[model samples]
Target: MNRITTLLILALLVFSCSDSKGNNDTNEKLNALRVELDSLKKSKAEASNASNKQIATFLTFQENNAEEAMNFYVGLFENSRIIDVQRYGKDGPAKEGTIMVATFELNGSKFMCSDSYIKHEWAFTPGVSNMVECKTNDEIEMLFTKLSENGKALMPLDNYGWSTKFAFIEDQFGVSWQLNLK
Candidate 1:
């Protein structure tokens, strides 16, 4: 081998080593960037969880006789109260001084209801109704027959294949009800 050839070979090896080192530095920087992005996503998720721990669902009912229905309902439940009461007279088609919305709690379940119209033959249809869940079949049958006492049954109390027991009815006051037992 000649002297020039040896010098050229050494210079090429040095240049290649420098380039590999640069590449390793670049790869390390890229890896750090990726880690930072993942940490940001995790931080965002944790912040959202800290802000709200649970999600709540609320149901609103429109009754023909809010005042009468609310009063009747208040007496039926143990812990029930008319949280907010409003009366509309000469303003809308609501019974003057009647309940606008009877927001109350029944067995710790929050509910809001209002009478949309003052005098109308309209009644609560099965299209919209409150469903009560029973832990046992006996409770289901008891509630079903009791609610059916002065009400009409849309579906008879029986062993519906879908659920262990179930029933549907509209109470005497025209309020629809549903009992589900599984």
Candidate 2:
């Protein structure tokens, strides 16, 4: 009976030690899984942010006048400026010193332009135009006059019922604009 009791006591000690080791292993595995889940969440968030990036308007000119047009546009509106300009070298693709690529902003809207080496039969049409909302009548008038200087005014500034004042003009660069007074 004494030997049997000693054997039972040793058995209990061995079982308890194995059970505690198992618990430790389970805890380590759970912690590893939590870290992996956090890493996956961070990766998904970065990919989502990249996919939601902003889109900018692009213009292609064949006459090597992209730089001129970009500069003129940057000067027209408030809070407008040229972000960058990459000019073509003496290569045969485009004229030397011409704008290979140019980035600019007009009234806080981003725009990109480039002088195309290949000439296409199509040019800018008035079908798609940039719409500007003016805060005052004077502002609309000023923009209309300046934008129509060397260009054609498709619709003169006047009340069109739907709007208090509006004008449609094709700028010298052949880009169309619709100026509306708010």
Candidate 3:
């Protein structure tokens, strides 16, 4: 029924039916079994890879504080951790010790953030924001309080027609977030 059992049965059948002396029929059967085993292994590998793959969101900042933002955001979520970061070298293009690129996982979701060497006129806008679906009131409240610190609250955390508690905030780093109790 299971993969291990099926493989064991196939192995038994292959080895038991094979002869000590090499024969054309036995060689053909062995080759067939080997092919089937290889196919099964490949199929298992593909399935595992598909399930483990994750989609990531990328954010960039012109203020050269990507590391700070990544630390702040990752600290707010549960079961979160910083993965890896690449820093700019002592070059003229980007300042040394600044983040060139950084990757982190917040609540199991992957995120990529970077500091831009060139400044852009356009910064973060309310047109796009990260939406967080929280399970408890405390979660929504904490997220709203932390993310709105030194930033503007687009919508105060309150009851709405759709959710009991909801808030839209632009974080100190100019990233917007919409927190809702689900």
Whole-model alpha-carbon lDDT for candidate 1: 0.64
Ten-residue segment with the worst summed lDDT in candidate 2? 1-10
Off by over 4 Å in 2: 1-53
lDDT of 2 by residue, 1-182 (tens): 44435545554554455555567665555556556556666767755653564887889998888988898888889989887899889965788888888878788788999999999999999998999999998899999999999999999999999898999999999999999999
Worst 10 residues of 1 by lDDT: 53-62
The lDDT per prediction is: 0.64, 0.83, 0.85
Highest lDDT: which candidate? 3
Task: State how far residue 109 of model 2 sits from its true place (Å).
Answer: 0.4
lDDT of 3 by residue, 129-167 (tens): 899999999899899989999998999999977888899
True-vs-predicted CA distance for residue 134, candidate 3, Å: 0.7
After superposition, the stretches of candidate 1 with alpha carbons farther than 4 Å from their true spots are 1-64, 74-81, 89-93, 118-123
**Better candidate by lDDT, 2 or 3:** 3
- After aligning candidate 3 to the native by TM-score, how far in Å is the CA of 173 from where it should be? 0.5
Global local distance difference test of model 3? 0.85
